[model samples]
Target: MLTTNRLRQQLAQKQTVFGLIASVPAPIMIEVIAYAGFDFVIIDMEHVMINPETVEHMIRVAEQSGITPLVRIAEINAKEILRVLDSGAMGIVIPQVEHKEQVEAVIQAAKYFPIGQRSMNSGRPGIFGRDDLADYMERANHEIMIIPMIETVQGVEQIDEILSVEGIDMILEGAADLSQSYGVPWQTEHTLVRQALDHIQQVATSRQIPYCAIPRQINQYEHWQNKGVHAFVLGDERGIAFRALQSKLAQFPVINTDRSQTEL
Candidate 1:
């Protein structure tokens, strides 16, 4: 496996590693994120339409580019977790991890037997295709990271127990989902959501596990950094496109003039 320095250091220092998400699933976009200098580009499998082959290709490109590739599997199943890990994702983010049991289930799905129950395959990223199944399975389980998303109120309550799990290396706060759950809307910095996140970060800091925030909000970065948050996923593929398109459109003379005018 290519060395994942940024991710490794974040885990070690409990410092935040900023990155982006890829909802669009195009390999070419990997180049954009890599060149953009994000720590990682997660290929989303939760809501986006990405095939296994495409994910593998994206991971391969990410490996070549030195940008860590992470996969957020939609479900908590062994087959799904194995598919992504075998494709060479440096990390796996499981959604809706609200309790210790659910986190344990994700662990089993992403890790090998004894530790968990992820089926082993030396297809591309294992032993250079030499097919050393036994050793590969053993090492892969220990080396791969399992990150759980705490998005619900229930998850917030159980954050400590989930982070305390042996194989769980990191936590991600699903601000949008969490906000909606609390009936406060999907703003990341809504007071209620921010309070909830502060609590989560507190627990993470005490336990020394990395907590990756979604989207890098410049306003909140310093505060979170001071609070021991090291893993920050800056934005997603679609978000970047939308922002860039808006910025570019605003540069047009007519568009700028019209947009800047106040209605009489």
Candidate 2:
């Protein structure tokens, strides 16, 4: 059964929420993050190899692990959105959203009629064939989260119009991609990129909508925290694991992999 989105509640209360990206499509990893007590988990199908069945498994784990589960869909396709929602994801994070029409399409595919045009199929989240789903539409619309990524210069410029669309629960940023769009590929800290993010914050603030930042460095958190941004996405599974392992391995000397030196 679909329950109220606690993530939504916390955000409504102006509490800062933290989450890690799910780059590894494993239920165990989902449990680890949940037990570690993050506010939510993003099931990343965009850059990860997560299939529908895998998403369902991770959602099951998150349900029990005490974390809100969201999926970052590959694109803003209606069927893809419906499939994951039915699999029990509480929200969606759309990537590379640069136009108001794209935002409108996402809202339409995510919500039921009277709000938007999501198809009627109570497959799993609504308990698979519930006769009262017609009645559940209101609750469903209320609980589902709609988040769009502002990853391009065009997206930043169109923030006001995109945020104007109804049913958008939150806004997410893609620093790396935004930097790329600014002609500074992978330079998330470039002044131009940083300014663009602040612009997003400014626009979202004007509209009274919550905005989330994915920090590329540690100090970025305190900066955004002062701006009163709603949430932060720290890192993904692979990056998290790699950093931990690298830290632990730092204690031991590395076997220099310079084969040229050893060739003699």
Candidate 3:
């Protein structure tokens, strides 16, 4: 069912919020992420092969578990955006947005009549006709977030114009793709990539748009925090889980010794 966007509310309160990119397509993972105290979760459909049914289930779990669910759509397709929003995702994170027109298209697809020409339906987000239709449309327009990712050099160049779009709720920095766009390919820490990200943050700050940073390095979170950034998407769940598993195994010295001996 539709509810207040807790992530937006936290940002409005100037509270620092943390979230993770859920590459895993499971409702249980969404429940665990919410229970673990994350303010939001970007359910990745851009890279992960999660189907519409699974995506809807994950959103339902997120709602039940008390976390804002945001879906990262593969592109700026109206149908895809409409389907996910109808499934009750609180926000849509459009990937690789490089032009103001792209942002406009997202608005057209995601928002309602006076805002944009989003096709209307009293689906899950509308509480299946439980809520008044007029009231639901007004609430959906206000609560549903339209977030765009600035990943390419072209996107960084057009940062000002992109943020100038009326309905953009927030801006997210994609350091990995930004690095690749700069010809460094995964060198997200490269000086040039860092400079581009800094530029994005500076522009977003000047515009008073919340900039969501993905802290790839250990110290980067504190770095962004010190800079007064209120939102962060701490890497993906798969990497987090892998690291946790590796750390757990490292505690068993006997097992480590046996593995080393077997390799020898």
Best by lDDT: 3
Per-residue lDDT over 83-161 for candidate 2, one digit per residue giving the tens place of the 0 to 100 score: 9988889999999999889988988898998989888887777877665887677778999999999999999898888
Q: Look at candidate 2 and tell me the lDDT of residue 79.
A: 96
**Candidate 2, RMSD to the unseen true structure:** 3.5
Q: How accurate is candidate 2 locally (lDDT)?
A: 0.89
Return the top candidate by TM-score. 3
Error of 3 at 77 (Å): 0.7
Candidate 3 residue lDDT tens string, 31-108? 999999999999999999989999999999999999999999998899999999999999999999999999999889
For 119-185, candidate 1 gives per-residue lDDT tens digits of 6565776746576667777766666777888898889988888888887787888888899889887
Which residue runs of candidate 3 sit more than 4 Å off their true CA positions? Answer: 254-264
The TM-score between candidate 2 and the true structure equals: 0.93
List residue ranges in candidate 2 displaced over 4 A: 129-131, 254-264
Q: Of the pair 2 and 3, which is ahead by lDDT?
A: 3
TM-score of 3: 0.95
